[model samples]
Target: MNLRLYSYWRSSSAWRVRIALGLKELEYRYAAVNLLEGEQWSEAQRARNPTHQVPVLEVERAGQPPLRLVQSMAIIEWLDEVHPSPPLLPATADGRARVRALAEHVNSGIQPLQNAIVLKRLREKVPGWDRAWAQQAIAEGLGALERAVADGGAGRFCHGDSPGLADCYLVPQLYNARRFGLETSGFPTLLRIEAACAALTAFQAAHPDRQPDAPSSDPATSPATSPAAAPAAAGRSP
Candidate 1:
């Protein structure tokens, strides 16, 4: 299993990739791409991903092109597809659909609206967009997600008693939400799921603050962060 993950320590997408790798118990090499320093823009990374993103999965075989894959969601699903050790998708089609829906709520909906790029754009244009609206948008999205999850499962994790791809995506989105000082106190389900994730070693090992490149606690680190963001959770099961 000659696998390599092109990662940024603080990237939520990269974080997702790390969680997927850890949950699957796949030992892969790590290649750091410093997003804060524009290292992702290098011709080398661009040749690999073409999207200029972190968390590129370089799947090497005995002799192959070393298949470089991008987009965190695709990478995670790919891991599940190839490994299939602990299935990331549920057994039934309906179960798989439900989990994917919840995951997409964060992946497709919330993430794009309040992404780093969007935040940077808003920061330059509007005065209060930096902390104010970003938090609001994130909260609103999470609120909707909470409602959606209510229609699914919220047992120990987002989709079931164990974590899946949905949980991986959810935790990172929640982490980013908290980064903007969003009021998640109203979202009890989200909080509970986050708690469940924190108690597990896999999730604990994948935390951003635990990573080397993550910054120290600072008021200017953004308004949405708190001391209570750390937690552990489960993953694909055999």
Candidate 2:
């Protein structure tokens, strides 16, 4: 299979898909979509995804038509289904439900509110509303995620000892939380899982700074170098 990922360096949605690809040990070409430069609004991108979002995965197989997958969660789930060695989901139905709930807490409940387009509109219509709104939305969403993980039988990760689907979503959302200046010190369980994730090669390779389109010299804003980049823990799955 020939895989190409349309991604933006700072996109949390794209970050999730990158982590899934790394964990699955899949090799893919990186097609950088510069969201900062309005590349996603171009006619080409609109044809790729009507939503005009980053993280569109293009799959090509011999003698078959190419498949264009949109939305981070859908793309990640498809990858998991096709490449199941290091399963992104749990084996049991109940466990799968729990992980999906946790993932959705970030994907559906949190991310859309602070999306770039949403924030841009907020900035234009209600001056000074973008940052404050993003901070509040992320704070509230993260607080709920922290409580859920604490009460949801979490082990080394959001669902179990191994990093799975929820971890993929959680790590990137936490990066956005920090980027928005939200104090993450209150979420111990989430932070612990994040630390565990940071140690893995998959997460490290998937970080925004490691992407080809990332700004070359912005160490202060780079999550890979930020204070939140915790020390690696032992026994983390690859």
On lDDT, the candidate that comes out on top is 2
* lDDT digits (tens) for residues 1-238 of candidate 2: 8777788888999999989988887877677788888888888889889998988888889999989999888998999999888999999999999999999999999999999889999999999999999999999999999999999579999988999999999999999999999999999999999999999988987888876568773533222221111222111122
C-alpha RMSD of each candidate structure in angstroms: 7.1, 6.6
TM-score, candidate 2, is 0.90
Q: After superposition, how far is residue 82 of candidate 2 from its true place, in Å?
A: 0.6
- Residues 1-238 of candidate 1 have per-residue lDDT tens digits of 5677777667888888878887888766556677878887888878988888887887778866668888988999999999898888899999988988988888888888887778888889996667777777788889999888876576788888988888898888888887887767888888899999988766876777655345752322211212212122122111
- The collision pairs in model 1 are 178-224, 179-224, 180-224, 181-224, 197-232, 197-233, 198-231, 198-232, 199-232
How many clashing pairs in candidate 2? Answer: 0
**What's the TM-score of each model vs. the native?**
0.87, 0.90
Q: Which model scores highest in TM-score?
A: 2
> What's the CA RMSD of model 2 in angstroms?
6.6
* Worst-scoring 10-residue span by lDDT in model 1: 221-230
What TM-score does prediction 1 earn? 0.87
Q: Distance from true position, residue 61, model 1, in Å? A: 0.7
User: Which residue pairs in model 2 clash with each other?
Assistant: none
